[model samples]
Every structure is written in structure tokens, then in C-alpha cells.
Target: MQLSSLRAIGISKSFGAVAVLDRVDLAVHPGETYALLGPSGCGKSTLLRVMAGFETADEGRVELAGRVVRRPSPERGMVAQAGTLFPWLSLRDNLAFGPRESGRGDTEEIVAGLLEATGLTEFADALPRQLSGGMRQRAAIAQVLANAPPVLLLDEPFGALDAQTRLRMHEWLRSVLAARETTTLLVTHDVDEALLLADRLGLLSARPARLVEEIPVPFGGARGRHTLSDPAFVRMKAQILDRVMVA
Candidate 1:
């Protein structure tokens, strides 16, 4: 049976007098990738933070695997733009940090596989400062995946990379997430990224963001770079662009 891996019910948040999110409701099914697309300053990251338990909402609640999320849990791994990796640790050790701290016994094997999967095997002994922006983000992803989280919260993880690198990261991330069947909630301003990666794409209004529309991508499962040229993809991107522009 299908299950909801993450849910936000009537979530509302404000910073001082500036309201950010308002009665936002979101549901990400198990093993599904959901992307929240909106304009700049639309509070997409704020909502993601709330879901990750990095920030609290003034109203409503968020749940992961049916458990109320009151604090950050390793069960839900989060990856932000860049610079999330520990600068002092090598790529391999960074991947092992989470599990080792949690007392998991398979740290060596896990780190080894993660390094290979993320294409960081050669740089296993390299520190975060020794890597490029994209490589650091990949390492961060590997570090989180090492914990084997059921849900992933990504906030513009590739936003800092160049166009070419961003596209590669997108393809890499899609494959890794699919292989693990991990439920993911991505906050992105990139339309093509959302169309290419999301099982369901949601649009949020300007500020005090609320989910204004939810679109289920009809593209068959297992997408790749070629999917970007599909007519359906082009159409959906246009439609979403129109909506976001108007909002």
C-alpha cells in the first residue's frame, strides 16, 4: 500500500510582522519526488526549513512517516545550497560522520559505497575546501544518504553551480533518489529542473506563500536529459511559467 512520507497541515509562519507561509498544505507520497516551484522570495526555502524542522511554524504541524516533527531527525535528511559539508573532514569521513555518531556499525562499507555512487571515490581523502561547489554538494548528498533517510529535503542544492554542472547534478540526483526510492521535497526556482525531476510539481504564490496549484507530471517514470525535449515537458514548463509569472 502507498503511504505519505511527509505532510504539512495548515502550516503558517511569520518573521516579526512579515508573514511568510500561510495555511500551506503539502503531501509527499512515499518514494515520490515533489518539487515546490515559485518565484524568488516566495518563501520556498522557508517552507522547506519548516518541513526539515529547522524552523517552526506559528500554526499547524509537519509529519514524517506519521510521526509529528518537532525537531530535526536523522530520518529526514536535508541538503541545502552549498557549504553544508564539514570543512575539517575528508569526503569519506564526512559521509561516515552521521552513522558513526549515531552508533551505526556499517560506517566503512556505507562510506565506500557512497563515495563511489557520488563519483567522489577518488576524492575520498579530500576535504571540503579541496572540492568545487558541485563536488561539495555531491559530498553533502552522499553524507546524508549514508544515513539512509527515508525522506530528503533539498533546498536549491544545485543553485550555486554553473548551468552545465547544475544539469549534471540534476541527472545524478534523480538517479540516486530513484535507486533508493527516497521521498524528496525540493524547493526550486528552476522550471526545467522541476519538470525534469518532480513526480508532482506545486506552485506557490508570491509572499505569505500558499500552494496555489499542484500538477502531477505525466511523464513516465525514470526521466533523463532527453525528457527535457519531450513536448509534454515543454508544455508543462510553459504552463507553470505562466502561472508563476502571474503570481
Candidate 2:
């Protein structure tokens, strides 16, 4: 079998006495987008953080490309729900920061490409406060991608956007991921978002969260607004919702 881009093996975590995760195992394959779907406060973000090495697992370990992950590194980049772009920096400078600090010679080129890729070319000089929520979120993602991480961890990155804006971002993100082929693990409570974006879905039970199911999203390539209304998509969404309700 092909190796996973990121893997959490028998992972568990707890805060004082309250267990948040319990023996959760998940693998995000190379170049594939995997979503962890669960109810609110279900430890989905905790699992993603553990995989990112920001939080250590109490019972198990996280692996990146088959190697044990010890701490956070540029090899795995995370984008959270709230935009993390520097308030004072222009979008261009924000995307350039990582590469420039890393002493990469092609910082300008990388920044330019990411700006174009994220449709932020026009807003390259705009500060985070000057942009819309969706724009800032895209900039945050672009900043992460500028590091060229093989694995991307998305912690409900679009949760704050309005419905229409979020839908537009879904389409844009689909094209971006298809082009870059970055292995991604997204944690979201939105079933439709998960169904729309992921190649597979990892359904988690309520806290002391555990993986209850690993569902394959049958929709293959570039999904659009029409995907939400498709019969197959509707059926799968209903089925997954039922499972989540009972989980």
C-alpha cells in the first residue's frame, strides 16, 4: 500500500480528567483531501493539532511520510478558522514572509504565483483589515502554501464565511488543490462542506472522540455548486447525517 502523507496511529488525548480523543486512527493519503467530520467540541481540531505537532498525543504518535513527528515544522502547515495573516503586512508581504525568512532565493516568484493562484493578485498590497473575511482566509491559506508544505491541516478554515462566499471558496479551493495536489486534512462540523471537498470522510463520535467510519466520497474531480444538488451527493449527505446523529 502507498504510504500516507500524514498518519495518526492509535492517538488519544485528555485534559486533566476529561478525555477529548480516544484511540483515534486516521491516515491522509498523498495528494488527497481528507475531512474529519464531527459534532461541536468533538476533538477534531485536537486531532489535527496533534498531527501538526502543536499538541502531543497522550497514547500514540503522529507520523509524517512514515517518520515520527516530534514537533511542529514547515513540512506541515496549518490554517485555522480565523485568518492568521499579519495585520500590518500587505498580502504580498505576508505570503513572502515565510520564504524570505527561510532564505529561499525565489521568494518573489513564490509570492507572485501564490497571489495569482489564490486570486489575490489585485489585493497583494491590501492589509488583512482591508479585505473581506473570505479574502483574508484565502490569504492565510496562501501564506501557508507559500511554504510548500506537503501536508496542509485545515481547521474549519471557512467556518466564518457567509454561505455564498463559502460556496465560492469551495469551488476555488477545489481547483487549487487539484492543481497543487497537496495532501490535506480538514476538520469541520459541516457535512456538506466535508462531502464537497474531501476524497474521503472520517466520521468522529462525540467527545472522547473516536473514528466511527471512514467514508469514501464518490464524487471524483472538481466539484461545483451543482454538486450540492446531485442525487448521489444528496443521498450520501443524508446517510452521513444519520450516522453522525447516532454516533
Candidate 3:
């Protein structure tokens, strides 16, 4: 299978002479969830911004399904760390916001379907303040999904939730992504989350981010995530830790 990959070739970025990414190469195959795992202050989020077309890379190019992603696009949807929702707008309206902003004609149907898909149907009329942490993120995700992007960029999407809620949301998101056959690139530091959700894991170094290591996660399907707790999984985690720490 070709995997309908998303790719970054010889990517590099710098901030006022501080090089963050040093000619990094990355690829996330279709239907495969990839995790960019690294320490805080590492360039994971910045790299994601570059991938999202929010920040232009000084040197590099991004391609999705062989087409260049030249600008910030609804085609590369994003769910950020913070809840990026309108306080005054109801959940339903928020979901419809993206499509409406894009001038898509069928906003109602699109929003309705996404709200239901993300299990927000009952909370459709609720404001951002009325929703729980998980719900807020879910709404943010729904808002992005309403645009029906081929590639989804998630930056610590479930990090705001409580531990229990985060675990539950992880399970739900894994199922949702698999069901939709969505191609995703998720930025997360949680080893368990990376092992559970990612098809492959990319480990990055601090300050100047480089591909310290790349490991195939072997989590082929949502149901396969549990295998991450096995002995083989522990060894893999150890290997990734070694790479991150040494780099």
C-alpha cells in the first residue's frame, strides 16, 4: 500500500539565528497516526505549525498525497492544545464555523454530522463555558473535522483533560480515527499515548529539533493498542527514551 502519505522533505526552521529544526525529514502515511514525541521546548509544536502552513519554513517543503500544501488550509485541519472555540457561539455553531468561513454551502449537514460523530449531539446548543475540558476539545476537533480535511494535525489535543478523561478520550479518538480512515499527525509526549496511537514514533531533541530516532510502533489498528503494555512495548519505550535522552 502506498499509504497516501504526508511528507516533509529536508525541513529546517530557525528563530532569529536559533535553529530549531535541522533539515528534518518526516512522513506520516495515510490512516496511520504518527506522534512527534519530545521534551518541552523542543520544536514539536513549531514543526507542527510549519506543517500546518501557519509558519513558513526557511527551508523545506510539505506534500500531502503528492500535492504541495502551500498555505494555511482547511485541507490540513488542526486541533490545538488550547480550546480554540468561540465563547458566545454554541457548540453546533462552532462546528459550523469552519465550513461557513470557507464558504461551503452545506454547513448545517456538515456540522450536524460532526457533532454526532464526536458524541456532542446532546451538547450541541451548549456554549464553550458549559462544556467540560474533554467536551471543549471534542468540540474543537469536531469543528475541524467539519471541514473534512484529508490530514489532521493534533497538538496535545487531550492534554487538558483529567487523567481518566484523557485515557477515555484517547480510546475514543483512536476508534474515531480508525473508523473514518483519517490520516493524522499527533504531537504528544506521553509514551503510552505515543505507543498506543501511533503507527510510528518520531523522537526529537531539545532546542534544535532533529530526528533523534524513528521507531515503528506496531499498533496497526485501534484494537492493537493494548499490546503496547506488553514486554515488547516496554523495550520499545526504553529505546525511544534512550534516543531522546542522548540526543
Candidate 4:
């Protein structure tokens, strides 16, 4: 059998007396984008952390490419909400950091490619502090992509940006992810964002979250900006909204 890009079987987690996840099973195929959506404090981030190997699950297991994910690895790249980019490092330097640290050859080539891929080539030399939130987030993703991870974990990565910026980031991100063909699992509270970015959307229940539903996005290939305005898209959002509100 072929290994999934990412897989979790009966995964559960807790913090002291509080249980955050309960037997959550999910799988993301290679080069597929899966989005997890739920209400506030629904353990979406916790689940992503588990898969990223940042936090251990109280029960169950997470696997990446047929291997158990026991700790953080470059094979599973994560992009968090904020404070991801190093404030002192320039965009170019930040992208180069991973390859340099991992002793991966062709650091310059990798950094240059990331800069161009993320449309950050013009600001390649700018420090994280000098860039806007969206730009920083893009650089953060670029930094992760530099390592050539097979699976990407995104935890509300654009939640901190303004609405307009977030939308633009969505477009840019979709383009980048498509071009790279990297497997991705995104956690988001926004229904629109989930519908726009994912090939499959999983809705989670409230605290001690479990998969409520695995919804396949109704749209066809390569969604565009206008796709969000389509009736089918709106209907899907409404359908998801109903479940998310009550989940």
C-alpha cells in the first residue's frame, strides 16, 4: 500500500484535566490540500500541532509517509498564525536558514526559487519587521518550503491579517501550493477560506474535537478569485456554516 502524505489514527489529546481531541482520524493524500474547520477553541490548532509533532497525543498515532511522527521533522513543515518569521533575518536569509541548518546543498538556489515562487524576490533583502503581515506570512511559508517538506501543516496562518489581505494571501497561497504540489492540511475558522483553499474540508466538533464531516469541495480545478462569488460556493459555505455552528 502507498503511504499517505499524512495520517492520524484514533488520535486524542489533552492538557491536564482538559481533553482537546478525541479519536480523530484523518488522512491527506500526496499533493492534496485538506482543510480542517470548526468553531473557536475547537482544538483545530491542537490537532495540527499533534500532526506537526509539536505536541504528543494522549492516545493514537500520527504518521507521515509510512513512518510514525514522534517528533518535529523537516518532512512536516508548519506555518503558524504569527511570529513565525525571524524578526532579524531578511526574507532571503530566512529562506536560506533551513537549508543551511539541515546542511542541505544548493542553499542559494533554494532561497532564490522560494523568493520567486512567493513573489517576494523584490523584498528578498527586507527584514521580517519591515514587511507587512501578509508578506511575513508568505516569507514564513517560503522558509518552510525551502526544506522541501512533503507535508505542510497550516494553523490559521492568515488569521491575523486584515480581510482584504487575507483574501489576497489565499489567492497567492493557492497558486503557490498548486505549483509546488505539496500536501497540505490547513486549520481555519473561516468557512470561505476552507472552501476556497481545500480539496477536502473536515469539520470538527467542539472541544475534544473529532471529525464531524469530511466535505469534498464542490468546485472543479484551480479555483479563481471569482469562484468565491459562485452560487455553488455560497451554498457550500452555508451548508458548512450550519454544521460548524452546531458542531
TM-score of each: 0.96, 0.97, 0.92, 0.96
Model 3 TM-score, 2 decimals = 0.92
Off by over 4 Å in 4: 1-4
Q: Model-by-model lDDT, in order?
A: 0.89, 0.91, 0.84, 0.89
Off-target runs (Cα >4 Å) in candidate 1 are: 1-4
Which has the higher lDDT value, candidate number 1 or candidate number 2? Answer: 2
The C-alpha RMSD of each candidate to the native structure, in angstroms, is 1.6, 1.8, 2.3, 1.8
Q: Sorted on lDDT, highest at the top, how do the candidates line up?
A: 2, 1, 4, 3
lDDT-superior candidate, 2 or 4: 2
lDDT of 3 by residue, 88-127 (tens): 9999999988889989899989887888788889999999
Q: After superposition, which runs of candidate 2 have C-alpha atoms over 4 Å from their true positions?
A: 1-4
- RMSD (CA, Å), candidate 1 to true, equals 1.6
lDDT of 4 by residue, 90-199 (tens): 88989998899999789999898889888889998998988889989998998998988889899999999999999999989998888888999999998888888999
